[model samples]
Structures are given as C-alpha cells and as structure tokens.
Target chain A: MPARADATSPWRSVLAPSWSLGRGADPLPTFVWPVASAVLLAAAWSLAAGRFDVTVFPSPLAVAREAMRMAADGTIWEHAGISAARLAAGFAIGGAVAVPVGLAMGLSPFFRRMMEPFTEFFRFIPAIAMVVFALIWFGIGEASKLFLIAYNAFFSIAMATEMGVARVERSRINAVLSLGGSRRDTALLVVLPSVVPYILQGMRIGMGRAFATIVSAEILAANAGLGYLIYSAREFSRMDTVVVAIVALGLLGLAADRAFVAIARRLYRHTLPEEFGP
Target chain B: MIRARFVEMVLPYLLSVAIMLGLWQLAATQVNPLFFPRLETVWRSFWSLASGDLGAQILVSLARILAGFGIASLAAVPIGLLMGTVPAVHRLLGGPVDFFRFIPPIAMIVLAVAWFGASDVAIVFLIGFSTIFIVTINTEAGVLHVVRNRIRAAQMMGAGFWQVFWLVVLPSAIPHALIGMRIAMGAAFSTIVSAEMIAGDYGLGYLLQEARTTLRTGNIFVGIVLLGMLGIMTDRVFRFLIDRFGGEHAGSR
Candidate 1:
C-alpha cells in the first residue's frame, strides 16, 4: 500500500486538530463570544437560584463560597489529588498492557483471530455495569476503582493500537525486510514509531474513559474521591458542594485532555503532518 | 478454499470462547464461590433470570436508552447542521459546547438527581444530556466535511438554499449522523446503567446493584451478560440499518 494511505488511519480523524482560534482574523469576537456566553449562563443560573430555593439550585456565588470553604479546609485538594492518583495509576497500567497485546493481535493473524471475538464481546460491556462485579471481586477498596478505570482504558487503547498496527503500510514492512532487518528490529524501529501517534490518540481517549469510569465507581462505592464527595454532599442537600465537585471534575477533565494533547503533539511532532498538530 | 476460510474465521472464535470459559471454570474452583461463582452456576442464573424479570429489566433499560437517544438526535441534528453551516452560530455556541462536553456524564448524576430526583426523568435526562454533545459534534463535522463542490454544483444549477441542503447536504451527512447515533446509543446505554445503579428502582443496572447488595455473584454475572448481549444486539441492529439504508457512504467507514 502507498505510504500516504498509512497516514489516513481512522484514529487520525478521531484526534481532529483542536479548534483554531482564528488564524489572522479578528481575535476580539473570538474572545468575546466565550466570555459573553459564560456571563449569560452565570446570570441565568443566578436568576434561577434566586427565583427558586438555594436547596434546589445553588447560585454561582453560593457555589463559589462553598468552593472557598472547601479549599480553605483543603478538602478539594485532598479529593482531587486522590482522584488524579487513581486516574494516573489506572491509565498507566491499562495502557502498558493494552499496547503490547494489541500489537501482537495486529502483527499475527493467529493471535488476531483468537482474540478478536473476545475483545469485541467485552468491548460492548460498559465499565459502569461491571461495578457490581468489581465490588464483589475486588471489594470497596482502591483496587476495584483501579480495576474499573483500567478495564475501560485497556479496551479503548487496545482497539486503537490494533487498528494502528493493522493499518501500517505493507511497503514499509517489505522495505525493512529487504534491508535485512530482523523482525524485532523492524518492530522496534518501524512499527513502534509509526504507531506512536495512534497510541497517543488512544491514550487520550482512554484517559477520558478512565476519568468517567472513576467518577461513577467512586460515586457508587468509594469514600474519598470527588465522585464520593459529590454523592455524599447530595445526600445532605449540599447543592453548593455538589456543584463545586462537578465543576472541579469538569476542570480536571479539561486539564487532563489538554495535557494529553500537549504531550501527544510534542512526542509526535516530527512524525505527524501539520494538520494533525494539536 | 471456502471451507478453509470458514474454519479460519470461525474455529479461532469458538476456541477463544472455550478457552475463556475454561479459565473461568478453573479460577472459580480455586477461588471463593461467594466472590467468584462457578460458570455453570452463573449460566444457570442467567437462564433463570432470562425466564423471569430479566426481560423486563432489559426492556426498561433499552426503552430509556432509545428515548434519550431519540430526543438527543431530534434536538442535536438541526442544531448541529445550523452550527456547521452558519459560522456565526458556530462561533456563538462552540466555546460553551466544548467546555460542557468535557464534563463527564457520570459527574452530573448528582446534579441530575437534585434537579429531577431518582425517577425516570433523571435517568433519561442524564443519558440524553450525555449523548447530545457527541451526536451534535459528529453531525456538525459531517456537515462541515460535505463535498464543497457538490454544494457549489447544486447552487450553480439554480437550486435554492433549501434545495441544496435537502438534496445534497442531508444525504451526504446521513452516514456521519448514523455513526453519531451509534455512538450516542452506546453512550446512552452506559449512562443509563450508571444512572440506574446510582438511583433507580428498575432496569438492568438496578438488577446489578440489587444483586451486588444481596451478594449474589451469579446474579451479578447474569446482569453483566445480559448487558453485553443487549449492547451487541443494539449495535448489530444499527449495523443492519446502516447497511440497508445508509447509501454510498454506508461502507465508507
């Protein structure tokens, strides 16, 4: 296959370039639109909170105060730190296992045929539904939470890796073989580097899935994470705290996504085309 | 050659299943039954539940997913089209949509419960809210990426704006919209389970949560298996529809 064909892997489309903030066009409206929208939403929310009871919908100001209180007591930091740690651990474990297995499946027809059905079957099973099984097997400890997140990340990353490897140009492999390179050398020098962007894209997607899984897992059973914080606060009708936790979760997700994009760009800058840049 | 190909495809799949089951059986014998029920027992539980309320639970969950996905598609398609075609609207809404999309649906469960309580509305809202963004984004991308020459040709033919959109744009966008729907379906299914597990009295998720509380390892397995089956079934149905009606772009992906 042509080398250009290899660049058209579906994962590239999935990792679409981040929205440009207008190249050389006017920047004022680009800046103003988001600010205006945020102000509008906050005003609407404040009005609704004023019209309704604070118990039902806490105002932005109320949530800010609650956030301040939680920050002062370091509650937000403690929960955020724990949640981040869990996400990091789960993502690392899942990505490490998934990439190699996926590569094997893609490289060997026997392994691919042997594993494809099982992977396809399990991929459909949402990680959230596994919460009960996870609880029963791993209990209400950190292991269960980690298992859930890792399970999510594993499938996503594995799928991407497999696809990436499968899409590697035949000519590239032939070229390497013609050069008298061993299989291991071909894999290390040609296959691995070619799939790095795809793997990074997979990890970014997997990170999002892991974060979502950890939230639900913590909400259902845990004692200390942000999900747990939101759930417990909800039980006590602390809408402000619930709102705070939700906002924190959103911010955390955004930060992680941006960080993943940054790292992917840096690692794959030399390899990927400009259009794929973050 | 045909027979060899058939074996090449089917034999390994069957063997994989057998191996997985064999491993499960072996592990079950070594582990506590309370934590890891025998595969046979789990199969039995699945059979029993299949004959009983498992059907109803599955139906309930499916209905919720369909409802949420349907609503999301209805709202998102037009808006996504508008955003894709109209730069002004895209500019106005893009930032907010981008910001909100990062907020995981699971994180909104508490807020959902607060707003709508532990009822069907809350569950449906969670699923719909979670799904709309994905569908919208996909639909927008679909419209944005429609062949510019096609639109120009239609316009040059004296086709009105509406005619160009209806005849050229909508058809071109269907494949991506269908893909978005598929993605939304998966999102809806998963979100519904999380919502139900957290705060519903019925559905497969509720069954799983209930089984967890009762320490019924067999029932938990049954719930999981049913969910997997349902997920596959829905995915297959979407595939069938896309194959039958998705036009030229049906097989593009």
Candidate 2:
C-alpha cells in the first residue's frame, strides 16, 4: 500500500519523529537506532526470560555472564578459531577447484553434459547428510569437518560461476578473437573479468554455507567448536551457554560475509559490481 | 532425426550416469566392499527399506519440510510487506533480523530440543527458523524495488491505501517472495536431515541416524539417494509453480 505517512494515522505520526522514514535528518540519528533497538530487544528478552525457569530460558545478562565465562576460560576463542580456520581452508579449496571446473562446464558442452548428472545429483544432497560419508571416507577428525564445509561451498560457487560464464556475451569473445587474442588470452582477459563478480558472490554465499555446515559438523562429532559447545550445553541444559554460542555464530557469520565483500571490492574494484558495494 | 536428438540429449545423461556407477562398481570390486558397497548390495538394501516404513519416513520428512517452509513463508510475507511499506516496522525489526538470520538453523536444534523436545514441532521450528528471514528479506526487497511510478499510477486512478496495496504492491512483491521461497526451500532441504537426525524419531534423517550407529553403509546410501530424489522433485515442482503463477515477476530477483 502507498501509506504516504498520512497525517491522520496516529501511530505513524508518533514513530515518525524517531525513526525518520520520510526524509532529511532525524531526531534520533542513524547510529543510535540499532543501539536503541538492541536496548528494546534486550529488555523484552529479559522480561520473557523472567517468566521462565533459568534452565529453560536465560536473560541477556545471564547469557552475557556465560559468554564472559567462556571467554575468560578461553574456550570460546578456541572453538571460534578452529571454526574460522576450517571455514577459510574449505572456502579457499572449494573456490579454487570449483572455478576452473565451472569454467569448463560453462565453455564446453561435452564437459557440461558429462558433469551435469554428477552435479545435479550431488547438489541436492545436504552437507549435513554427508557427515557419515565424510566419517567413512575421511575418518574421525578435522578432515571430515573440512570436507563437509568444502562440500557445501563447492556447489554454490560452481553453479554461480557457471551462470556467470554462460551470461558472457558471445560477441565479446568474438571481439577478443578479432583483436588477435589467443583462446587463452580471451578466457583470461575477457571471460575471467566478467566472471569475477559472480565468483565473489558465490564465495559470499558459500561462506554462509560453510558457516551453517560447520556448526552441524562440529555438533555431531568434534572435540571443540561452537557447534560442539552448543551441543554439550544442550546435554547440560545450559540455555545460557547455547544462547551465547548461537550469538557467536551469528556475529562470526556476519563478520565473515562483510569481510568477504570488503576484500572483493578492494581487489576486484573494476569487475566487482555495485551489489558488493555499500 | 530422432536418433540424432537422442544422441544429443539422452545419450549424454546415460553416459554420465553409467560412468559414475561404473567407477563405483570398480571401486567396490577393487577396494573393500564393506566401505564401498556394490551397486547390487545398495540396491537390495534400498529395496528392502522401500518396502518397509520408507514411505512413512519420506512422508514425515516431506510434511515437516512443507509445514516449516509454509509457515515461515506465510509469516514472512506479511511482515516483509509491512516493513517495506511502513518505516516504523522496518526500523523496529531490521536489527533483530540482521542478527538472527546468520545464526545457523542447526544451532537452533539444541534450543528446539530443549524447548519443544525431540518431536515434530521441534523439527518444524528449526526449519521455520531457517527459512523465515530469507523470505522476509526477499519480500521486502521486492516491495522496495517496485517502481514508484506504479504506485503513482494507482494513486492517480483513485485507489485507496488497501486498494493500491492489493493492486500494485502485493502482485509485484509475490514473485520476489516466490523466488525467496525457492531459495529457502533449498535451505529447508539442506537443514531437514540434520534437524531430523538431531531430534527426529521417524524421518529419513532419523533413519540415517540409525544407520550411522550400525555402520549400515548401504542403508545410509539409500537414505542419501532418497533425500536427493526428494530434493530434485521439490525443485521441479517449485520451478513449475514459479513459471505457471509468478511468470514475469519470478526469477528476476
């Protein structure tokens, strides 16, 4: 609806002075909004927590205490670091392999057809469902966890790269060829530049998948990681600890995503699209 | 002509499938059959299970996936529309959504088990948690991206707030929401196996959980195959719906 900040609507008028939906400067600036929002959210949270047992629901303060305790003992950092390293390694390997493979798929019909059945089938199999297979193949350790994350990253990146490559104009390739460029030069100089944005986007998405899959892998079978922390907390009925770990996962995921976009912008400033920009 | 067409399309797929199976068969014979089950063994295992509660397990998992995805998509659309149309709603909920959306749904299984127990409702909650934000954000973006000129046109025709919404915004936003739902469906499938494994008693994930304990590699393979089939089937259905209903607005996002 075109709700136009109607003067007759009382709620609109009341909240308008604060949130500044319409225009110009606000009584409450942009910076203060989230801080205020967080306060409101925390207040509501603590109120809800107060009605429930501590074991069932923990207040923000209680969760903070637990987070502080984990931090003090250095367990949270240990888990977070392990998870981060695993995510980095998996994302790197998956991107490195998927790009060239995806390029081949996009460029050559023979390769595309030959790879399609495998890609189409494996793409549907959830990474979480592969933990057992990972265990069976890679054994009981970091290898399985890294494999799961890389498995999750691979399909998304490869698919995006393929799409990007497919979208590259034939005329552009011809133009490169007309300029006496070799096939290698056309691919490296023309196709790769066009595909970089898509690759970066795929990497961002793959990072999210890595983060998502990492927790489950850790939860299922790991000595340490945030997922394991949450899993162990569930065993103890420590809602506070679970809450803290979840928050950590959220922060880390968001930070990694933002960091990815930031780096992509700096490195591929020309090729990176505005979607990657602020 | 028919043979040529078949060679172009059908043969490639057959070749691909054959190559993969041939490689697996080769491994089973060359390596350990315990780890690498023969195709026949896996097929037999799958057949035995398919004759059993496999139908019920598939149905249970399917029901939970649809239920969770449906609820989250439904709830998200209205909220997303509100957020897009109204500033107060957007400002109020934006921070919370930004924070919560990144929390992996697997992380919620613990809280879900604690709160709802290892039950259907818990599994549903986990799925719903995974999908809600994706749909909501997509819906909101759809609304935001709606051409301002269209709203102006509706206003020129003397459409009221509700009329303009029903006429202009909802239609424009729905396809975007559909696209979001499609992506969220991917997330939904990606998370369900874990949700079921963690807290389920009778889904395919639960079956995998059981197989995991016994080292029943054949059963595990069967479960993965079933899940893949389900995934592909749902994807086809979603694509069909998007094409049939959403049309121009669909797939643009």
Candidate 3:
C-alpha cells in the first residue's frame, strides 16, 4: 500500500516533519531523522530487555560491561585480530586466484568448458563439507580455515569476472583487433578496463563469502578467533560476552563492506554506477 | 539439427561426468575403498538413501529450508516495499539494514542458539535472517525503480495512496521481488546445511555429518549430490513462478 504522509495523521505529523520530504534545502531535516530513529531503537531495546527480564537477553548496559571486561582481559583484541587476519588472508588469496581463473574462463572458451563441471559441482558443496576435507588435508590448523575461506571466495569472484568479461563491449574488442592489436594487448587495454568494475564487485561479494566462511570455519574448529570467543561465551552462558561478539561482528562486516565500496568509488570515480547492492 | 543441438548440449555434460567417475574410480581402486568410494558404490548408496530412512532426512531438510525462505519473504518484501516507496524511511533504515546484511549468519548462530535455543525455530530464523537482507535490498530497488511517472499519473488521476501503490508500484516491483526471492532462496539453501549441521538431529546436513564421521564416503557423496539436485529444483520452481508473473507483466509492457 502507498503510505500517506497525510496531514490528518498525528503520528506522521509528529514523527515525520512535513517540509523534510520537500526538495532542495529541506532534505537536511530528513537526513537528521535517523538520529532520532537510533535513539528510539536504543530506547526500545532497553525497554524490551528490562521488560522481558530474560537471562539470555542481557541489557545493553550489561553487554557494555562484558565488553569492558573482555577488553581488560585482552582476549577480545586477540580474538578480533585473529579473525581479521584470517579474513584478510582468505580474501587476498581467494581474490587473486578467482579473478585470474575467472578471467581465463571468460576469455577462453576451451578453459570455460574444461572448468565448468568442476566449478558447478564444487559450488554446490557446502563449505562445511570442505571443512571435513580441509581437516583431513590441512590438519585442523589456520591453513584449513584459510582454505575454506579461499574456496568460498573463489566462486563469487569467478562468477563476477566471467560476467565482466562477457559484458565487455564486443565492438571495442573488434576495434582493438582491427587496429592490429594482439590478443594480449586487446585483453589488457580493452577488456581489463571494462571488467575492472565487475572485478571490484566480485571482490566485494567474495569478501562477504570469505568472512562468513572464516567465522564458520573458526567456530567449527579453532582455538582462537572471534568465532571461538562467541562459542566459548555460549558454552559458559556468558550472554553479555556473546552479545558483544555479535555486535563486533556486525561492526566489522559493515566496515569491510563500506571500505570496499569507498575504494571502488574512489578508483572508478568517472564511470561509477549509482545503484549497487547485494 | 534439433538432434544435433540436443547432442551438443548433452555430450559435454556426459563427457564431464564420465571423466570424473573414471578418475574417482581409479582413485577408489588405488586408494582405500573406505576413504574414496567407487562411483558404483556411491550410486548404490544413492539408491539406498532414496529407498530408506534417508528420504525422511532429505524431506526434513527441505521443510526447514522452505520454512526459513518462506518466512524471510513474508517479512522482507513488505518492509522492502515500504522502504522503497518512502525515500525518508529508506534513507533512515538502509544504513542499519545494510550493516546487518554483511554480518555472516553463522556469526549470529551463537546468538541465535542463546536467543531461541537449539530448536527448529532458531535454525529457521538463522537461515531466514541470513537471506533477508538480499531480498530486502532487491525488493526496495525494484519498487523504487517503478517509473515515477506512473506513480505521479496515478496520484493525479484520483487514485488513493493504496490504489496508486497497488496499481503502479506492486506490479513493477514484482519482477525485482522475484529476483530477490530467488537469490535469497539460494542463500537459504546455502545456509541450511550449516544450520542443520549445528543444531539438528535429523536433516540432510545431519546425515552428511554422520556420513563424514563414519567415513562412509559413498553416503557423503550421495548427500552432496542430493544437495545439488535439491538446490537446482528449488531454483527451477522459483524461476517458474517468476516466468508466469513475468509473462503477464511483459504483456502489459
């Protein structure tokens, strides 16, 4: 249903200022709305936490205390560092391999045909299944964790790279070829520029998958990392610690995503598309 | 030409499978049978699962996936529409929602367990939560992209708010919503195995885990195959629905 910001509706009138929706200089009022919303959300959370009086549902204050405790004990930083390092490692490795392989598949029909079945089959196999093999192959160490993340990252990047290559203007390639450009030169000059945006997009996607895999792999079997911290907290019913870990996860994930987009925007300032998500 | 076209498509797939099986069979014979089951053994295992209690496990897993995916759509689509239609609301909620979207669902599994306990509801919620953001963003984009002129025209023509939304926004957004749902379905399926791995006593994931522990390579292989087949079928159904709606929408266009 189309929602009416009707004059008669007091809730709308009070909650949403009339002039905020207007054009030009009026957008400022609307821009500040989320601050009010943040306050409201926090208040609601506090109220619900208090009202419920549930053991698992720790109040915000309690979570803050737990956060402080973890900080004081120095375990939080250790776990956070471990998780971050793993994510970085996996993302770098996965991006490197996947982008190259994806480019190859996209540019070469023979390569695509050869790799298609393996990629499709492996794509369907859950990372958990790979963890079993990783444990067997890498012996339950950081390698296993990195391998899982790398594997997860590979598919997203590969798909994106293939898409980017497929979408390269055919005319541009033909023009380059007509100009006596070699295959390598055509790929470097014509294809790479067009595919850069998609490669970045694929990296963004791969980061999400890599992060997910890292956390899950860590949680499944690890002595260190934020995943292990949360698992440990859960084991002891330390709801506050668990909450803090989750909040940290949310923050890190958000930060990594924003950082990628910021870099992409900065690099591709001229040709950047406005709408992108997922 | 038709037969040749059919053969062209089929031959590559067959060749790939035959090569894979031949390699696996070689390894199975050379290596230990327990570690690397032969293709024939895996086929037998697949049939056994189809005929036995394994079918229930597959059904249970499918039910969980459907439940999670269904609930996510119900929650995401309406809210996405609201955000899409209202610029102010979208601006406000978009940042926070996007933040939550990136947080790996597995990271939240610990919280999910604590919040809802190790029950089916928690598993379903985890799967749903994992997939919701993609659907929300997609749906909102879909709705927002609905031609502004259409909305304005509807408003000008004595259409009420609801009527304008129903007549103009909903139809335009359906295609996007469907795409989001399809993607989210993939996400839901991707996460279901992990959710089941952690919390369930019975499911395809649970069965796969058991197979791993027992070193029943054949059974594990069978489980993996089923996961792929199930995922493909789920996608096919989603596509069918999209095409059905898309055809009518296309006619209008």
The candidate that achieves the highest TM-score relative to the unseen native structure: 2
Tell me the tens digit of each residue's lDDT in model 2 across A45-155. Answer: 999899988888899999999999999999889988888898988888888889998999988887888888988988888888988989988998888888888888889
Instruction: Note the residue pairs that clash in candidate 3.
Output: none
Q: Score the docking of each candidate (DockQ).
A: 0.48, 0.59, 0.44
Which residue runs does candidate 3 get wrong by more than 4 Å? A1-31, A52-54, A273-278, B1-9, B31-35, B247-253
Docking class of 3: acceptable
What residue pairs are clashing in model 1? none
Winner of 2 and 3 under TM-score: 2
Q: Mind giving the per-residue lDDT tens digits that candidate 1 earns over B1-253?
A: 9999878888898899899888888888987777678988998988888888888888898888888888988999988887776555666677777677777787888778778888888888888887888788878877777777887787688876567778887887777778778877777777888888889899988998888888888998888877788888888887877777677656533
Model 2 chain B lDDT-worst window of ten:
B244-253
Residue-wise lDDT of candidate 2 within B1-253, one digit each (tens)?
9999888878989998998899999998998776788999999999999889899999999999999999998899999988877766678788798778888988988888878878889899999998999899888887777777887787788877777678888888887788888888888987898887777789999999999999988999999998898898888787877777785854542
User: Which candidate do you rate higher for lDDT, 1 or 3?
Assistant: 1
Docking class of 2: medium
- Candidate 3 accuracy as lDDT: 0.77
Instruction: Please provide TM-scores, in order, for all candidate models, with all chains considered together.
Output: 0.91, 0.94, 0.90
* Higher-lDDT candidate of 2 and 3: 2
Clash total of candidate 3: 0
- Model 1, residue B212: C-alpha shift (Å): 0.5
Tens-place lDDT digits, model 3, residues A98-199: 988999989987667667887876776666656666766677788988888888888888988888898888999999999999999989998888787887
DockQ of 1: 0.48
Where is the poorest 10-residue window by lDDT in model 2 chain A?
A13-22
